[model samples]
Target: MEKTFLELISENQSILFKICNVYFREKVDKEDYHQELIIQLWKAFPDFKNTAKFSTWMYRVCINAAIDILRKDKKEIKKLVFQKSTYIIYLIMGLSPLEIRKDCLN
Candidate 1:
């Protein structure tokens, strides 16, 4: 069972990288995020019952893990920036909500 799960993951590994790329830009950061997502997928593997397709399950797991990471990183960024001022955060990166989501998702 574990072997089968690893096989499925190998074939659809891009799903993991896509999520990681969106959440992290640097190569080191992306690799770290990829490892974390793989861990998340493995932890959730036992509960999977095939109600959904493997890719679908992988997508959900990857997205949820990435979102969780993004949230944590955002909070950290907020903390660091909070010391400076809200004005810099908003002004320095004037990306729209839609633009930000599109950039990440793509």
Candidate 2:
């Protein structure tokens, strides 16, 4: 299971990179978010049912991890400026901020 998970994650690593790039600015914060994303993905791996594309699932997980970090740092969130591409992703994916926050925190 661990091997398979690692393989899947390796294939989808760009999802983590894109999310970290979108959600964080500073090098340290991006590094921290990358670690947090990997931990969350591992914790949630056992329940992955493969009903959806792994990349899509990974995108959700990455976003949720970012949101979790953002919620913890309200000041950082206020300072956040969503890039055009990030906004496009949100629009295209229909990832509502409220829904993400509720899903992430609970």
Cα RMSD for candidates in order: 12.1, 15.0
Which residues of candidate 1, in runs, are more than 4 Å off?
83-106
lDDT at 47, model 2 = 78
Q: Using TM-score as the measure, which candidate wins?
A: 1
lDDT of 1 at 38: 88
- Cα displacement (Å) at residue 19, model 1: 1.8
Which lDDT tens digits does candidate 2 get at residues 48-90? 8889998898889889889988888886555564444555676
lDDT (tens digit, per residue) of candidate 1 on 36-92: 988999999999988889999999988998889889999999887885564455446
Model 1 lDDT-worst window of ten: 83-92
Identify the candidate with maximal lDDT.
1
Native-referenced Cα lDDT, model 2: 0.84
lDDT of each: 0.85, 0.84
Worst 10 residues of 2 by lDDT: 76-85
